[model samples]
Target chain A: MALTRNESAPLFSSDTANTLRLIAYLALAIALMVIDHRNGWLVQVRYFASAAVEPMYRLAALPSRLARSAGDAMSDRARLNTRNAELERELLLAQARLNRLQSVRDQNERLQQLLEAQRSLDLGVQLARIIDVDTDPFRHRVTIDAGARQGVAVGEAVLDAHGVMGQIVEVLPNTSTVMLITDPAHALPVKSERTGLRAIARGNGALDSLELQNVPISADIKPGDMLVTSGLGGHFPAGFPVGTIGSIRNDASGMFAVATVTPSAALDRSGEVLILHNLPDPVGPPAPAPAEGPPAESAPANKAPNP
Target chain B: MNRLRANDWLFWGSIAACYLLQLMPLPQAMLPLKPWWLALVLMYWTLEAPDYVSLGRAFVLGLVGDVFSGDLLGEQALRLCVFCFILLRFRARLRFFPMWQQALAVLALLLNDRIVLLAIRAADGQLVPAASYWLAPFVGMLAWPWVFLLLDDARARLRVRDA
Candidate 1:
């Protein structure tokens, strides 16, 4: 039998029913968005869904990897051989440098241990692999393979081989999302390593651009000025290299000048990152209770025992 | 013949496959160019098999897209509802049109959907400028004819098997 619509039925028939159902679903989605945006109740739901979808990502990525391998196998054998030889030579030089660096690092660690013994502080580092780029291009975020299970905490600084990338914004059980320095929502307190001029480095959501905002037009800032984390906010450690000034443009109507910064780190292509877990205590041990009298006078009785 | 059952199965299966494709991981370079693959598939089915597919199905699928993409939840659903409504209303005229003409129409529809999405996103405080955001529809337009042909072939095969 050929496909036919029953004539006696109204035009609104089955199609109309489907349209109504779609409208209902649409309404439900809107309600979900409102609830998610306002209450953050959907984060757990999103996490569970992401976990379910993670395997699909791995499966889809396999074909792309295979295609890349196929292309590598087919192209420029002689050039590949030459490149391999050059890489081997470079590897030898790198190994030599690494050996010397290890010796220096060992000496530095000994010195650091002595200093830490005097000062009394604990420090550590964790490495993580980039898993997925944010689905929204406008949001400069990346998910890393490390998460809460690995002691990866939100607000920890993320760095690449070169310098500071961003901070952990969200931590899941199996993954964490890093909000990069290039995301518009992210702001880091930064200072010029050269001039010591301080400003907030804000992300403009571009691949290579950051904005140093609220700087005086007359400030001694220029192109190529190095920017480093100021550590003023206590979110990120101080003295981490962040970016370098690219261009400074003075606003014609205002006292403030906008300076563009290119991040020192390869923010767009970093496959591996280190999360510095050394966040400083936000509130130093509650100021030792002020003594009612001179410490010598108040503690005279205890002093004999102390001696 | 089991044509009706086969067509129904293909219709539902293709819809699910399209959703799966949307969920698939793509590199940065390929991600932006990935058309609203599920939407395109739904559009195809709605046009080719109006008896089986309808605006409600498209809207529901759009809601799924919204959920999966983590976009403003109702945005995709609304866009899909409007798109399906328009397409269903013009189904007869659309089916008879030449391939190029049909592609142009699809391009217009996709552009409209993108604009609506952009507007809603802007209202939600996203700073998506008009220039870069419009590129997806152009890519979608380019892919439309191929998607149309592929789904049409599947539909024809199902019809033959039914006969």
Candidate 2:
């Protein structure tokens, strides 16, 4: 190769040039963050980046998947038989429970037909494996193996066997990120199962509790009452279990109550979750409370059936 | 030609292996002790073969790391560029340090990385992370000598011609 060594090359190679490059890169990064957070200019880029990194996630999950398969393979015949028997028994019990639910559903449909209420939510559960978890203190999230390819969409509710887990905030081609209900930025509309008292449950960035905001002190909600998605404004399907009200406190100002709810799902160990990809068609927002009846704050949920 | 390629493999291969290690998912309980694998590997190359891995390379690798780890845009990019800048400027001194002292220097760099991470998170309005978040750097520091020796041994055994 013939080298054309020019005097101009020295300027590009000098120490000052390197410093200039550093400053330029840092400036570029800062510009990216400012533009990204403000207008989400890089959201699509991030999504594509996530798709590009899907292989890394698969690589990361490979060992654990192998271990689990190996453990299952190594179990002795007797142990396998015992596990099968246990599962069969559980299935039988579940079927018996379903029989009762079948009758209740028929009753509900008949009543709904008479009342002309919007049809009930057809709860469809799709299984997904949690491939990666974000331990960032401020953003609690998990990446699932399901994505747009699996019909998972943003704003779809995710649940484990126990109860509501969170909702899909972002979807890539082959994977999706679920922002856990415990994340500070996440909020869900919920109602007291017993009193029909409505409130919005917002994550406090804590693992164990969600906070209820703007709940009036006069509201009849109490600790130990169950909260279910009311389907108001509709990010989640109606009647899904959200949490148990753990504690409630009247604020110092005396007008409103602050309540803490213990999440029903095991947020820490959700190995598998079911994504509710479709909201049972939401009935429009419920009739606002009468002026004379207590004022219950309802935040318009941006997506789904308010069943 | 084959010998130089082997040497390149020796350098890039170790970095790739470190990435694999970094990407592996650890149980929640063991997450805190996960070493800074990419940083350690990058440090090894920047000190031993400074001409091969440049600041642009580091910046790009950090962007990949950020996206793979699902961190905010440019968080890792900025952190890694700073890391490379410091390493390049002080390459002569850092290269001559005894193995033990080298580990200490790595500890310092990793600690700086942690501080930068905290500053970024705070600026993004995130709550302070747990004490456990600070443990990985120490773990990486302790693992440095072993990693350095292991890569050295592997390269020597392969008899890769130097670039």
Highest DockQ scorer = 2
TM-score (C-alpha) between model 1 and the true structure? 0.80
Candidate maximizing lDDT: 2
Worst 10 contiguous positions by lDDT, candidate 1 chain A? A298-307
Every model's DockQ, to 2 decimals? Answer: 0.36, 0.37
What's the distance in Å from true for residue B47, model 2?
A: 1.1
Error of 1 at B149 (Å): 0.6
**Model 1 lDDT at residue A217:** 81
Off by over 4 Å in 2: A1-17, A49-51, A74-86, A103-124, A132-138, A196-200, A204-223, A246-260, A278-307, B160-163
Question: How do the residues A182-257 of candidate 2 rate in per-residue lDDT, one tens digit apiece?
Answer: 8887889999999999999999877779999889888998899999887776577667788999988987787899
Error of 2 at B33 (Å): 2.9
In model 2, pairs of residues that clash are: A231-A306, A234-A303, A282-A305, A282-A306
Q: Weakest 10 consecutive residues, lDDT, candidate 1 chain B?
A: B23-32
